[model samples]
Target: MSDLKTEADSLNRAGIKLSYAADPLNHPLADFKSASHDLSAFGVLGSLLKATGEVREGMTELADVVTALHDEWQAEGKAMLDVGKVLDQVDRLLQESLARKHG
Candidate 1:
């Protein structure tokens, strides 16, 4: 059991490190989304730890809720970025077509 717990902790730490590896290109909200999802496992581990009295530390129930919100907001932000890019391309194309027609 101790070995299992140790491995779990190592994996959790690894996940956190991996999340930040893309810091150059990733949005802050993307990191928030990744962190929320990664740390969510604590929601389950929190109960188990309390039941076993392994440690008095654990995540709050609100963590999961916040994570859910982050996920939704990240998706929305990505969609908006995509829409903005497409709109810019379309506007450029229209301008080019009008210029060609008149000139």
Candidate 2:
């Protein structure tokens, strides 16, 4: 059980890292509105996934968001620096959620 938990946690972190890396604007979006929308969607899907600890669903949602944003980035022809913040948020949120579960 311990090993399983460890593996799952590692996978979750990796998924978050990959998803963050895939974000179209690796930087802050100059037009913050679109970025806010992206982050909101991420937060909601993340909450859903965390509530159930459904790793697959979480990964899928993260992947979809990144893909969509990647497309959007290409369309807009811009780079971003906000990827680290987003990934950090995910890591913090996921860890906090797990902590809540254990407590």
Candidate 3:
């Protein structure tokens, strides 16, 4: 149980760190999208611009996936903690019942 709680705490901490790391990626992705649009105004760089757009789209998808994963980790960590609490409560109740019966 303690180990479960410890792992949950670690997972929550990791999720928080992932949130922080993923947030910075949004700014750069947005910047790249904006830059891609700006480059679209030139006809000579059309092919290059298309490639850049594709790369930006992939990056955006990657960021979305990372964000979703972080959310899942946070939720799972909380769920684990809740389960641990429930298990601890049941354990205490059993101990008390046994003590009362044997007293």
* Per-model TM-score on C-alpha atoms: 0.43, 0.26, 0.60
Give the runs in model 3 whose Cα sits over 4 Å from its true position.
1-44
Q: What C-alpha lDDT values do all the predictions have? A: 0.51, 0.51, 0.62
Candidate 3 residue lDDT tens string, 1-103: 4554465556556545544554556677667646644544444775676676676677667756766765775566566556656665666676788889999
lDDT string for model 1 (1-103, tens) is 3343454455445545444444443465455545544544445755654443322122333444555665665555555555545555666676788889999
lDDT for model 3 comes to: 0.62
**Deviation of model 3 at 2, angstroms:** 11
Q: Which numbered prediction scores highest in lDDT against the true structure? A: 3
**Alpha-carbon error at 24 in model 1, in Å?**
17
Q: Point to the candidate with the largest TM-score.
A: 3
CA lDDT, candidate 3, residue 71: 70
